[model samples]
Target: MTGFDPDWWCDGAALRGREYLSISRDGVELARAELDPQSTDVDEYTGLDLPATVVKIEFFEVRKQLRGRGVGRWAVAALIQHYEGPWFTVAAVTAAGFWTSIGWTEARHAARPCSSTARYLFNANALPSLDHGSDL
Candidate 1:
């Protein structure tokens, strides 16, 4: 079990003054789960035997003032495009319903009982080979 950091909302000075690009127009931070490049955690989660890197997107929240403008969708799309892994996986909690509404299939249901609700895994495979300098 993992917890979302509260300081994630802090753009600068809080996170060592590091810059986090906002996926939304109002600069709301996008929650991102970065995987180990060596694929150490892939075997433990995804059933796929192949070693692959993944990034999990848990939530997409826009300010109440900026709701219903499709900004959240745009942010998620940008994140999916920016992620350059051989495979991508997400353990969507709050957004599981929304993920299913799109093309993401629920890989696991009631995967964890210790928690209050079930867990879901959504995955997508990337191209076999992508150019280093070009966008895939």
Candidate 2:
């Protein structure tokens, strides 16, 4: 898969508080991810005291044609590598397995809602301790 090039993606627009990444093949956009630094959706959903630097993935989508072709996985992995920090997103029911397959673990406080929040801690230092035995 072709990797993301920040300079190529963010060249024209001056991204202030948000960052965007797009995955494409042969000039066609296959998937996209948007990060919002100010979002507290994760904390709101999970009721956890996440650090302020933890950004939320405001939006993430893969083209229908490319759904199971590893495009989304590659895009998310690239995002984690690029940002190198804590990232979280509220995932739709169809996407929970995808997130888990990509190494994201559901938050300890997360319920098995049809749509629930999931998190990826790229930096091990940012991972919080949780009591696995506790019920959400």
Candidate 3:
């Protein structure tokens, strides 16, 4: 998989509250997502004065014509890495397998759902202490 250009994601994410990102492979756009780049001085995990990055995928969709070809997984995983830590998404019940297959843990046990759909999280670097945001 082509690595995400780090220089691109953070700049756009910091410029506004949420950023629109699309994943394309072989020049064809396969997926798109809405990401919230939470840039803060204090880390949510440690409460230390350090740079912390938390990205939330408010919406994600794979092109209807191409559903199960690993595009969605790659797109999501890339965003998770590109954004760097604690990625959250509101996912449909039917898509639970896809999320879990990619190592995202269900948030019902870790955090309460604040939305109609279920929530999933991937906080690779730290011990999770989840706080669900009503907006997501």
Candidate 4:
């Protein structure tokens, strides 16, 4: 049941603020997620007012063979447990449904302008209580 862990300082000592999580198995890299602790892209893209402390899953991808094997869900869940505050991501059109299935909700902001892309938010208060190994 061993899963991924966030190598918070993967970018090295000098670039500590820019963090990335490497998901691996037996030393093989399976996936990686770029984390932005102070991302304002949510506001810039959707006009939603999110706190500066919110962790944005800026970029996430798994190897093609790893898809549908629950790796993505585990990575996200691990991140939620590792980080504090809210979580959010501007999901690509193709991946919006997956995000929703995993407990993320479409964040609606009155000021949000009409856009072709979808924005999702995982408010800490609204998160479902899930066990570490539970299927998301």
Worst 10 residues of 1 by lDDT: 10-19
Candidate 2 regions exceeding 4 Å error are: 1-16, 42-49, 91-93, 110-136
| Model 4: per-residue Cα lDDT over 16-81, one tens digit each | 465777777778777777777776565543445566666777667776667898877877877776
Weakest ten-residue segment in model 4 by summed lDDT: 1-10
Compose the digit string of candidate 3's lDDT tens values, residues 11-106.
444445878888877798787777677733222322222235546666677776778887787777667656656544444466778888877766
List candidate 4 stretches off by more than 4 Å: 1-17, 42-50, 128-136
Error of model 4, residue 71, in angstroms: 1.2
> Can you list the residue pairs that collide in candidate 1?
none
In model 2, the clashing pairs are none
Q: Candidate 2 on 34-56: residue-level lDDT in tens?
A: 77756655443354556655656
Ranked by TM-score, the better of candidates 1 and 4 is 4
Clashes of 4: 0
Better of 1 and 4 by lDDT: 4
For 53-121, candidate 1 gives per-residue lDDT tens digits of 455443345544554665555555555566554454555556567656555555533344355443343
lDDT of each: 0.45, 0.59, 0.59, 0.66
Off by over 4 Å in 1: 1-8, 11-20, 24-40, 43-50, 109-136
RMSD of each: 7.2, 9.3, 10.8, 6.1
- TM-score of every prediction relative to native: 0.51, 0.57, 0.59, 0.68
